[model samples]
Target: LERIVADVGAAVVVCEAATREKVVAAVPDGAVVVAGDATPASGGEGGFAPMVAPDLAAVIYTSGSTGEPKGVTLTHGNMSFVADSIIESIDMEPSDRILCVLPLYFGYGLYQMLTCVRLGATLVLESGFGAGGRIVQLLEEREITGFAAVPTIYQLLLSLPGIGEHELPHLRCLTNAGAGLPTPVVRAVRSAFPDARLYLMYGQTECQRVCRLDPEEVDEHPDSVGTAIPGTEAWVEDEDGEVAAPGVVGELMVRGPHVMQGYWGNEAATDRKLRPGRWPWERVLATGDLFRADERGYLYFVGRRDDIIKSRGQKVAPREVEDVLHAFPGVRDAAVVGVPDDLLGEAVHAHVSAEPGVELEAKALKRHCAGSLESHMVPKRIVIHAELPRIGSGKIDRRTLAGWSPRG
Candidate 1:
């Protein structure tokens, strides 16, 4: 098949008939294209020697700071270690079935699939999220025991006109990641899927899952991202370069088996992200997030460290925007931040809260920001909110702001 001949070294299975033909046409000379569900009928022997190297398991693509996509090469050992860590921590069972809406291209989604396959459990896949109706239907029809998604999915699903608890009887567990979830949306999801275990997961493509929350402890510690996954170490480093104590906010650093080997073919980025021989895994992924751990070592993710803008060349954290907004007469919550611009490197963007029955004006909020924050920190654009978009795992859908609406 073309994939085989073109040095697409990974062993790819053709799930659909048309896809099979395409693979055959592409690499007709060398590929062993296994078609259909029946493995024995295709002259196949079990446990074929892994065609990939020990340092290669799956290559997942992700968007980086350069505005270009990059492929992250994770070894089989890298992936296997993380999978075992997840299984060991959560104690997955053979009967578990996850209703998977995540795309295969995502490392998290692929991890879910590989984890299921390795554990001899089933992962029910869906072609699309469709709507709350479709998700509700899938839960009943497929008897899905687990679910996982980003913040956007949650926002879209919760907006469905007709949804209730009866529709999600089989959803035993759920996970949220990709972005940080808003507190209100997280509360809403917990109310809807009360029976299902909810975990707020955090990770990057460089390293798959760095942390996972315990469901029972959600209400007790709504802001915390939970303890480090087994085989993972998380700590806050102070500005002076020492480990921070409990409740002291600082840069979050992680060293674990799940940390990636390196960015494919980019030594500069690889060296920047992965510190060699740092621990048992020999690599530690430096997360850009600022966080603090509780006395018990439960980690709380604050926000991105780079999100803070240097206004008038003076550093300003976006959390300050949210802090100021909450002080307003009627505001309950806020997500103040910066967006890229041609001239300013970044421009302030404020999405704020409104009191019940009180219409908040952009001009008024703009004045409020001007009074509360430095002139440079005042949001150039003000967006009033009835509700902000969130995804399934209860995170803000900041990507939706690409087409933000300006209010009077």
Candidate 2:
């Protein structure tokens, strides 16, 4: 936190009572501290000026699951464009009440707040999804019309006993974007909240939102991340920098007004990601994610470019393997990674957590994978855990898992 404050050169910080002392102690000398709930000081209107569209609005840092976090600099125009797109795409209204469990510092959670303010909708804040029962109760008591969560939170909600028995007529919209919600979890969520429309979205902090799958199309393409969001263009480009044919896996590229200006104090990294588009002045984000589009132009997430495993001389997408694992009877969540192997340049390895009160064996999971996945894609080794390790962003900590071995 101190490093972030120094890197961004923050002159002022807002904190609540709980964190006021710690925040004051850590902030750099001469930095102003203001209570988030305290009334503003008088006589501040003399020098105030309205912010312009091009002015920097927020700097949301990435999850840093892979390495050091990069600050994604978003302009007022970027945030406004995405907010409008979300309101239109989701058909959000002023009368709706949205429940936000994600951290406000994260892009996904921040957008929820921005959209609510834009439409004058009610924004219900929760510190965290403590338990499934509590979340369900909030949905019922708060009369939440819209809810957003990542796959991990959804997995926890589905694991709760009698989750489907709970009635939530007020839940009209469900959005998942941090990570792709497993196909099994998607179906289970729809079954539990039949009245709510589930939207499968895909995006990165560099670009607020690139695409979203319409609720009506979930069944037809449950695995797809759908088409580009309004006013944005998304496509897959191959190694040669040409648009990839449908079903051909490649890096996902996004072109739109929502792209970040650049990484804060990291020009090399910025140049690597945000490159010039067709026009000399235009820039497009080269998302470091692997994706494929169907003939119908629906996008499907393959895996992170750095997460792909080359085993037995064949490139394997961990998402494909993880999907099959998610479908297993006793499995609640799963993660797969590549391990150094003497025989096959790298071997496929996996870790999975089972549903509550269910016993899972590595052999049984291996058999399940054999039934669904190709021999090369099958996990050579499987480990069961009470719960998979996750980073702050709710994504599986693959970097931590990468160093594990059979001996350990």
Candidate 3:
């Protein structure tokens, strides 16, 4: 937080009571530091301030999965556009109540609150997703109409006893983003919420939402991230910047009002991302993610261009292997990476954590994956760890694992 404030040259800092002194000491001289819970002055009138849609609203930092985090500048229009699109796509109602388990600092969690307020709905904010049973209890007690989470959250929820047996009639929708949910986990979610609509979404911090798959299409296109959201255009571009044909892998590009203005104080990076479009006045985001499109225009994530692994003259996505690993019974969490190998160029390696009291053998895991994954997609090596490392976003810290050695 301090680094971000310093980098952005913020004029004021608002924080909770516990962090007021720290924020005051860290902010620039003459910068105001206000308590988040402080009451307004008596003379102050309460009303909406006059502002234009293009005015800056907030700056969100990327998760820094690849390298240093970059601050994404968003305007009032950007957030408002995304919130409205999501509300329409999910068919949110004014009386709907949402249960948010993600951190408010993250875009996925923040949008839940934004959408609720826009629709005049209720929001039940939890600090984090605790034990599965506790979350189920909250669902039953609160009568939540909507639930939002990432793939890992659903995996944990499905691990709980009597998960599929529980009745959640009030939960009308379940939305997922951050990373693609495995096919098995998607099935588990369906079983858990039989009557609810399951929405598989794809996005980044730069754009709050890019695409959304309808519940009816889940069975037909289980791997697709769906088409572009309303008022947005998404496509895959080849190395020469031409639109790639269906089933051809290329970087994904998105153009919409929800796209961020640019990276704060990073013009070079901004130029690389927000580049020229078909028209001189238009700018589209060149997402560094690799993806493929179906004949029907549904998008499927391949992998991050930098994260994609080359082995045996073929490309492999870590998520694809990780999905297979997650399907094995008693597996709690899993992460896949490419390791240096003279024979295969880059060998597929997996690190998995098991549920408490469950024993996992590398040989058994390999045998389990052999049934589903292609021979080239199977892990060359498997390691069992007590827990998989996670960063602030609750995503597996692949960079840390990439350089890790058991001997060290």
Candidate 4:
């Protein structure tokens, strides 16, 4: 955003605290300044004249590994539209207190911040999602009304020793994102939080969130990624370019106010995904995920495009294998991948991290898979690593850790 202000022939006005005071001062004073959490004792406004920009608001960046990260520029109209939509769909009230662990830079986390600010609710900011004890304590301390996290945190929290029933009663609800929750993890979470609402959502960074499974619909249709949020349009397009019939796999596409404008400085990437070609709307964000819709209109997840594997002319979903692996005793977490093969086009491989002191061996785990999975579906090899690879957001980076030799 600072770069955008400078490159767009405008100076950036920033507000910061003592630690960031030097950073903001470095910017040209010719730019308009606004103080955030760093105002003087009197709380007086800056002397500079306020400049108004219509529909345009600042962008927040998350691509930390990349050089010179750019912000996602969302207009005022866009912000108002999505925020109103979320508040309406979830029926958010001013009394709600959200436990926010995600930082403001992330759109998911930023929406949490915006929702709290707009609803006049309390935002109990956490340093991070490390374990359950701290969070359990905070929920009681702050009377937290809600929570949100990716699947990885769900697995960790579910596995924690003290996260069982009665530890957290004040939690009104919890949300999951970033990745799909394995069925086992989902069931485990249900057991842990018997009272709190559990919403299994599916979405990408390009679009904040599209589908959400409400708490009531969980038991009747736990696997279904709940119907599209109100005020949003959802359709699955097959390879033939038409709405997919019920029970048929298709690419999930979402059209709504929450969708992002485009990628930063990457017009081609934006054009590839956000094309308004066939959709009647002004824009649509095409998700790469493959999912099937049941006759009743609930969305059922299959797997990611890159996560599918083909073996001996038969297509296979790695998640199916991973799901079976998770059901096995002693297995803590697992990621399945397809490796190169001589007979088949690809060979199924399983990489797992087991519970501490569980005494699970490669052969025993293989036997466990053999009992549940078909002969063809069984993994040819299993690799157990000490720890899984993690990206900037602390979720598993499978591409980086897959195929690496297991820990001795």
Query: Best lDDT goes to which candidate?
Result: 2
RMSD of 2: 2.0
- Positional deviation of 20 in candidate 4, in angstroms? 8.1
Task: Specify the poorest-scoring 10-residue window by lDDT in model 3.
Answer: 39-48
Cα RMSD to native, each candidate? 6.0, 2.0, 2.7, 4.8
lDDT of model 3, residue 190: 84
lDDT of 4: 0.73
Structure candidate 2, residue pairs in collision = none
lDDT of 3 at 238: 91
**Which residue pairs clash in candidate 4?**
none
Off by over 4 Å in 3: 20-31, 39-49, 312-314, 340-345, 368-377
Per-residue CA lDDT of candidate 2, range 140-242, in tens?
A: 9999999999998898888888888877878899999989999988899889888899999998999989999999999878898899999999999999999
Model 1, span 335-384: residue lDDT tens: 76667777777788888656446678889878888888888888878887
The reply for model 1, stretches above 4 Å from the true place, is 1-53, 64-66, 276-281, 312-314, 318-346, 351-378, 383-408
lDDT of candidate 4 over 1-408, digit per residue (tens):
445555443444544444356556455556655566544443356764544433556454544321244445566656766767777767778999899776666667788888888889788888677776777778788888888887767766766676775566678788877667777778888888898888887766666668888889887776677888878877777899788999888888888776777766668767877868455758877877788888878888887776778887777787788889888876777888788788988888888887767766889888998999888888888887766676656556666544455352
lDDT of 4 at 78: 66
lDDT against the true structure, per candidate, is: 0.71, 0.90, 0.88, 0.73
Identify the leading candidate in terms of TM-score. Answer: 2
Worst lDDT run of 10 residues, candidate 2, spans: 39-48
Q: What does candidate 3's lDDT look like per residue over 128-157, in tens digits?
A: 785777788889999999999887688778
